[model samples]
Target: MRPRFRRRNVASEGTESLGPSIPDGLWSKCPRCRELIYTREFERNHSVCPRCGYHARLTARQRIALIVDPESFVEWDAGLSPADPLQFVALGEPYPRKVAEAQERSGEREALVTGAATILGVPVGLAVAEFGFLGASMGSVFGEKFARAAERAAVEDRAFIVFASSGGARMHEGVFSLFQLPKTIVAVESLSERRLPFITVLVDPCYGGVTASFATVADLILAEPGAMIGFAGPRVIEQVTRQKLPAGFQSAEFLLQHGMIDAIVPRPRLREELAHYIRLLTNQHSASPVSFVTRQESDR
Candidate 1:
């Protein structure tokens, strides 16, 4: 028999502690394992915890820096911004105002950031969504940019890669937003039509129309560990079906077990793993070891 338990938290009931605050975002607590992680080491480790191997959320710019070869990324459709055709208003802010605020705060015109870049000297079209921007919701601009990225990949004979992180289609856009689902599906279909390899990297909290569409229709679908990937959230699913979901349901690991995803990848190994797959599919030549040293010094 064990002794009766006493609460470890001394804080008052109905209140929560967010842990010790750190300046400049250098320290954080892991949600899964409750381990404290140093941000510098976390970034060096590609936002993965050295202790428990948990993957942390990353911004679009951070991802680009980690994945692409140095100075190789070129922006595509950099000037496009969403329009307020419906003039939506909510929470005392107009739709356009909200869009502007999100853009200013995130430093992106839309949630999606797309471009062409070389992965280990292999040309590929890259699109990464910023979940910091309005939950990375998909709007018409998001779909259009992805279509352009896919088309560019086909034209350049390069592989297409998209890092998907979204809550769903933008609710503020109404039916017009929903239309983007089929539109993006058609764009993804073009990749298949052109016989171009399309890979999707599903980030945390991928769901709704985006997940239901091109996100799942990839030649190879990979997800970061512990990412939430599903059509609807677990709570909604439970509410609708009135059944308890299996433990860890809708997680990237759960999806892999159910044959929904190809594999769970860590951020640090993503570039190498993706390049390996691309080379295998394209029959590209083997790459030399990466080095910035001169040939004479290397031979010596």
Candidate 2:
């Protein structure tokens, strides 16, 4: 007969249990400061760590809700989804399967979310990248959505704004992904033909082809505190050049000091600042600040 083993219970064996177990996800550790913070408080603060001021990434919906006027957003290109033209496979997993997994994980059809919305009563075209969706990689559908949104903004004569967070272009799509670089650049140019303002807010971990293309070619470029904005990450650059980089390399503050970005706007002040810029850029600054401030404060 085969020998049988029995599992032992620590409680029955007289080992003391640590008090009632704490539930999972009740607290989140700050990546920068390594402090445990209550999840509710973290969400209330817009995902910025209270201790170290780390601006955690937000879901696309959360970002839209934070930036746009309540119930004012109407999405576009909702049916557009990614396709595997190359029939690509990685480590025996098909591209379509990967995309399906990403869709399930992110609860979004594609990485890019484009829509029309009002900010502080001023209409604008908006696009926010969902990093949870395949690192917000720019694939064909991603490019199409952005191009269409830009075209719509130009046609409607509204300022266009984008909150960009990406790990660059999708490698699964191969060369088709690289096609988006110039395509989006042309789209931005179309906006300029109508003299519409194009603004981009670069969030954390924005790099690769997206940054190389349209993310930087804006009327104004703003970044959150400590965002990593660059074509190649510091690690790759250091590896290539075989040299040590300066402290804070590729950070938003570093980019700002180097004149790559216009301003570093904290998350709380972002809406007001964007409204101020929109009003100034579009020559619509005649509105009284008292009414606007009151409305904004009440909403907050």
Candidate 3:
């Protein structure tokens, strides 16, 4: 008989350079309750903790798949890339290298992905944030993508929809990044002037510049269950005001009850709800046929 092939442990091959092992099959710790549960179980609940209802970060692809029609998405600005204007370096790595690493981890070149797709056959422009990219901070590329997406929507006369999830402006990009806040806001305003419907879906941990700008200006705002939407994070607010925040102060459900959000949408129902809105808006604005208008004029 041939020698029994032994299973070699490849886990240690990259250990020396890659550092210590992450606990395998460990559940994500709940930020609020500090409870540990299975990751698979958390995912099954749409990334919400069953114990304390903590929202977990979601990937751009996951959001896209959740919100867009299958086989319908066509991505935009896929070639746009970040530039190292400051030539900054930190932790033995250049800024550009860090950006590349973030992109690799997120499977996206920037924090946001802009695209066109239908939700239940209603055409709309979509922009989803990839939180894996340095907490989906707004930078030059992010701003460019948002502006371009808005312009595209205006040109196509399609509804503009954005899923905003970010920790705010990218610090590495400095003031240049902050400038994008107003820039994106202006683009959204232009869309508003055209009477186009702009919808925003707030995801967990949306704060900083993002909450103050384009996110707050949407014609209709829907937030994911258990998301946090605010200008400053709870920690910062606590430190600045020296006041303890109430439990679930910034949660999506809390905001919904307080009339801040139009609705608290669960992951599965997001597409259906968006489609209903799109169809309503499209029908409300659709022009009557030329023949019908001419017949009306003749009767008059």
Candidate 4:
């Protein structure tokens, strides 16, 4: 039999770290509630803070498991890795070397994981961004993955859902990286032609070229509580405008008040929320939970 057991990861409680090298049985302090929580239990609750209901950041894999049906995710573009086409360097480290180090740390080839999955037995195309991978910055590859996810969803008549969590465009890649904004927008804009639903789930710290492009143009935009969403970082915007920004200017709740997004979804209810929207948009009635079965299984 294949070995199924894995080594333990030693991350602090309630924090999300899936790698086996992390130290185990550590406790984590909730940033919002200031309460100590067992790391294992925190993961069991899907990384949401039990005391104050704050949603913790999740790894790309953990995020995928939250909404997709068990064993139903078929990933695409997993081999795509970031390249230092510009031969860029920053902070005294070469860009390619930096990307290599980041890949090692995050256990992902790139920041985004694109795939087909079923949410509540309703097929949907999903793309989740991993923030731990170099702040989940969008490079050429990241944009390509996002674009292809939208295309796949459109072609398959499935709802397209993107989880956006980024610090912005990868500065290391320079202009080549920034240009992907338009590329992704073109891909996202194509979804409308098919009348497929496109949803953006804005996570923490979404800013820069990402917010200025495809992320803001979703058919329905949903943000997690306290997510910072804006075209620029608050400090930079304040400097440019030379004004004292209001408190929580770019927070998820703030965006909702300004009519920037459709709604603010709590972590616990996100699956239900997305399923509801997908069903209405697709005219799909309630589907019983159906696993992917082979022709032989069906015949049997």
Model 4 per-residue lDDT tens digits across residues 1-300:
011112233354333545445566445667766666777777777777778777777888989998898999999888898878888876788998988889999999999999999998888999999988988899999999998889988888888999988888898989988999999999976689989899999988788888888888898999999888888788887789899998788899999998899999988889989999988887777756566676559978
> For residues 20-119, what per-residue lDDT tens digits would candidate 2 score against the true structure?
3444455676766767677778878888888888888788999999999999999998999999999999999999999999999999999999999999
lDDT of each: 0.84, 0.87, 0.82, 0.84
Looking at candidate 1, what is the lDDT of residue 281? 80
Give each model's clash number: 0, 0, 0, 7
| Model 1, residue 25: C-alpha shift (Å) | 4.3
C-alpha TM-scores of all predictions: 0.85, 0.87, 0.79, 0.85
Predictions: Cα RMSD each: 8.0, 8.5, 10.5, 9.5
Candidate 3 yields a Cα-based lDDT of: 0.82
Greater lDDT among 1 and 3 belongs to 1
Candidate 1 clashes between residue pairs 3 or more apart in a chain or in different chains: none
Better of 1 and 4 by TM-score: 1
Which candidate comes out best when scored by TM-score?
2
- lDDT of model 1, residue 48: 76
Please list the residue runs of candidate 1 whose C-alpha ends up more than 4 Å from where it truly belongs after superposition. 1-26, 287-300
Model 2, residue 53: C-alpha shift (Å): 1.2
Number of the candidate with higher TM-score, 2 or 3: 2
User: Clashing residue pairs in candidate 4, if any?
Assistant: 10-22, 10-23, 10-24, 13-27, 13-28, 13-39, 14-39
